[model samples]
Structures are given as structure tokens and as C-alpha cells.
Target: MGSSSLRVYGGVAGNDRKAERRAQLIEAGLELLGTGDGEQGVTVRGVCKRSGLTARYFYESFADRDELAVAVFDHVVSGIATATLEAVDSAPAGTRAKVRAGLATIVRTVAEDPRRGRLLFSPALSSTVLAHRRVESTRMFARLLGGQVREHYGIGGSTALDLMTEFLVGGLAQALTSWLNGVLDLSEEGLVEHCLEMFLAVQGGRLEPGDGAAGLQAGTG
Candidate 1:
């Protein structure tokens, strides 16, 4: 019985060490991929060096650099989603307030960690794996936004709502990307205000048909 207990303890210790190494690798990937140098600096050797782990440990955790990049992207997006949801949930009862809270959380998060912003929004980091994960994350956020629309405006799930949510999600993405890349020239508060106004317009049905194109233009400008 003592031998069996020792074996189980040894197994747990090994698993914990492996988990720690995996986390280190993920952090290294985030540092390399999320920085200004972008994906070019995310080689396995670079990550291993940054992580202070050997290549063998990297291979144990990820199949390749693309996988690591995707993991880092997912991690960043997950944190953003969590913070937004928490802010929205904790806001006082009002659709506008909740929306502002959520949007503010997102803007503040990116502003706090510009590296995460670049990892998430930079066109330069759009490798196939990262791009695919981006689309997935966008769809998830759109669904959350759709829920908010339904709760706030009594909109049912229909083709039109689906299309509207997609447009809103895409517009938000472009707006954030431009803001992060310095094209928008907006302060953090200004960025949140712009996004909040657009969301409010959508809720009020105030946006004209051509407004979507105009919004994209403004965001890029």
C-alpha cells in the first residue's frame, strides 16, 4: 500500500511539473507573438529561449508554432471575454449602462496591454491558425451581443438579427483594430464612447443602409 501511495504521489508531481512547463511555454508564446515584431519572432527556438525551457518541452506541449500562436490568441480573447462579461453583469440595471460597462472593460483591457491588442487585432498576425481562431472568437462574441440585443430590444432570433449581429461584430473588430494600430487617433475614453454610440444607434434603429460602409470608413480613418 505504501508503494502504491508513493507511485501516485510521484505521478501527481510529474503532472504538475508538466503543467508548469506548458504554462511557461504559453507565456513565452504570448510575449513573442503579442509584441510589435509579430509572428516572425515566434519561432520554436525563440519561445523555448523566452520560456527558459528546452525544445523537447515545447514539442511535448504544442505540435508547432502555429498551435502555440493559436493558443496565445485564444488565451488573450478568453480574458477579454471574461472581463467584459463581468463588467456587464455587475453594472446597474440599464441596457445602455451595461453596454457601456462591457465596452469600457474591453477598451481598458486592450489599452492596458497593447500587446494583447496587437495579438488580437493586427492583420499581420493573421496566420491561418490565428485567423481561424479569430473567426471563432468573433462568432462567440456576436452571440453574446445578440443576447444583449434580445434582452434590451425584444429582438427575436431571425435572419435579420443574425445579419445585424455579424455586421456589428465586424464593425467593432475593425474599430478596435484601427484604434490599436493608431489609425483612429482616439483616446481610450473616446474609443469607448464611439463604440457605445454606435451600439446605441443599432439598438435604436437609427443607422441608415449606407451607414455600415460609412462606419467602416470612419473606423479605418
Candidate 2:
């Protein structure tokens, strides 16, 4: 809050340098948390080393490893959420169209960089700090889903909407985790199509079973 924090050195503002260092630290944290077994294996020294910064710089950015882990988690989640929201908003009106657009964004975003997926759902990274961040992201996504359904259906709040969003969010986390880990055995588009068809059968209009499966088989065959 003082001019000292705003002071410039070597043509770079102090605040700018601090932000760059913070970003570097967050990226370092992401690498550690995403690749390691869990937070137990992560250390401040490890992150500092990875970022090529010293302990003082690490302390300037994060209080501890836990805070860094949460920051890393949030960085990934915010990116995916922003891109998906843009895709969904730009898509044609209607639940199926909007959700399919959003689904493609989410799938492609993670598939392009699977470290993002592992950081989000891999059991290996489920430390207390990340677990809480995971819950927050889940609920946040649930709210987004619920808001979408409401917009598409022109309906008010309801318990059914809340339950459906929770179901969709949980199901997505599990399904995408499997896909990312190779357990789902579906290509990126196949996974997106499958989810678009199966995940919202509760809407109950034209989402017959095998809708996506038939398409997937044909595309693969």
C-alpha cells in the first residue's frame, strides 16, 4: 500500500516484478502438485527450487505450501471455467446446445494439457488444502450448471435443479478423471459427445440412450 511497494527498479515496477514472481511461483506449485503423489511430497524448498527463486521470494508470494497448492488449483480451475463460460455463452440457445459447447471446451481444455486434469481429480493430489479447493470448485461449477438450466428452461430455483447440478458436477469429475487416466478409453470428442448425451438425460426430451454411443461407434469404425 506504500510507495515502496510501487517503486521501480531496472525499468520494471516493483509490483510488476512481484506479480511475475507470483505467477512463476504458482506455475512451480502446479508442476509439483500435479506431478507429485500429494501435498505431503511438496515442500516450499521444492517449489522455490523449481521456480529458480529463493526462500524470500517464495514467502513473498505464498504463506506456505498449502497456500501455494490452493493457488495452483485455482489457476487451472479459473482458466477452464472462463473458457467454458465463453463457449457456452456463444453457443446457440437451448440446453443441449449450450451444454455441449461448454462440455467441448472443458474436455478440450483438459485433454490438451492432462496435467490440468490430474491436478483437478487425481487422488494423488487430494491434500487438505486442495480437497477444500476441490469442493469449492465443484460447488462453483454446480452453480454455473444450475444457472444454465434455469436460463434455458426459464424456471426459478428448485430442489430438483440443485440436485441435478450436483449430480452433473460429481459425475463429470469422475468421468473426466477416468478419461484422463485412460480408464475411460474414449477419444476426446467421443468423451464429450458421450457426456453431452448421458449426463443430462434428466432433462427428458430427446436424449435417448445410445444417442452418443451410436455416433461414437460410427466415427471410430
Candidate 3:
């Protein structure tokens, strides 16, 4: 019984170590991928070096650098989504306040971590896997936006609502990318305020329907 228990404990320790190493590799990938040094920096050797692990350990967690990149991208996206949701939920009970809180969280998150912004927005850094993941993330956010529209306003599901949500998500992504790249020329506060205005307009029924403006107005108004 003692020998059996020892083996079980050893196995559990081994598994824990493996999980820790895997998490380390993923963090290294994020560091490399989010760098201004660009995609060229995101090599197996570079990630392993950044992770303080050898090449052999890299293979234990990932088949190749691309797999690691995809994993990092997913990790970053999940973090952003969680932050946004938490901000909105914690805000005072008002549509405008919730919108402001949610938008501010997203802007601040990317602003504080420019690498994260690059990972989400940089065309030069995109891979096939990352691109596919981006689309999936956008669709997921759109669905959430649709639900918010329904709840915040008395609107039901419709094609117009779907399109409006998609448009809002896409436009926000582009806006953030431009802001991150220094093309938008706005301070973080300015950016959040600007986005809030558009969101408020939508909620207030300023945009027209089927055309992408209509549903937002109905939902928010």
C-alpha cells in the first residue's frame, strides 16, 4: 500500500509539472508574438529561450511554433472577453454607463498592453489560424452584443439586429486597431468617449434599419 501510494503521488506531481511547463511556453509565445520585433521573433528557439525552457520541452507542449501562436492568440482573446464582461457587470445599472464601462475596459486593457493590441489588430502578424480565430471571436462578441441589445432595450431577434451587432463589433475592432497603430490620433480617454457617443447614438435610435443603423437605434433607444 505504501509503494502504491508513492507511485500515485509521483504521477500527480509529474502532471502538475507538465501543466506548469505548458503554461510557461504559452506565456513565452505571447511575449514573442506581442513584440514590436514582429513575427520573425516568434521562432521555436526564441519562444523556448523566452520561456527558459529547452526545445525538447517546447515539443512536449506544442507540435510547432504555429500551434503555440494559436494558443497564445486564444489566451489573449479570452482575457479580453473576460475583462469586458466583468467591467460591464460591475458598472452601475444604466445602459450608457454599462457601455462606457465596457468600452473603457477594452481600451484600457489594450492600451496598457500594446502587444495585446497588436495581436488582435496587426495585419502583418496574422496567420491562417489566427485569422480564423479572429473571425470566431468577432462572431462570439456579436452574439453577446445582440443579447445585450435585446435585454437593454425591448427589441426581439431580427436580421437587422444581427447585422447591427456585427457592424458594431467590426467597427470597434477597426477603430481600436487604428488607435493602437497611432493612425487614429486620439488619447485613450478620447477613444473611449468617441466610442461611447456612437454606442449612445445607436441605443438612442439615430441609425437607420437593415442598413445597420436601424437595429442599434431600436435596441439602445
Per-model TM-score versus the true fold: 0.83, 0.88, 0.84
What digit string (tens of lDDT, one per residue) describes model 2 on residues 95-166? 778879999999999988877988999988877778889999999999998787666655566666677789
**Model 1 regions lying over 4 Å from their true place:** 1-12, 152-155, 205-221
Given candidate 1, what's the lDDT at residue 132?
A: 88
Rank candidates, lDDT, best first: 2, 3, 1
65 in model 1: Cα distance from truth in Å?
Answer: 0.9
Q: Give residue 182's lDDT in candidate 3 (0 to 100).
A: 87
Cα RMSDs of all predictions?
Answer: 6.9, 7.5, 5.0
Runs in model 2 lying further than 4 Å from the true structure: 1-5, 206-221
Residue-level lDDT of model 1, residues 1-221, one tens digit each, is 44233333545765677778889998999888777477877899999999999999999889999888888888888899989988998999776788899999988998898888888888888878888888999999999887766665543565556677898889988999988888899999999989998987875643333344333223233
The lDDT of each candidate is: 0.81, 0.83, 0.82
Q: How close is candidate 3 to the true structure, as a TM-score?
A: 0.84
Compute the lDDT for candidate 2. 0.83
Best by TM-score: 2
- Indicate the worst ten consecutive residues by lDDT in candidate 1: 212-221
- Which has the greatest lDDT? 2
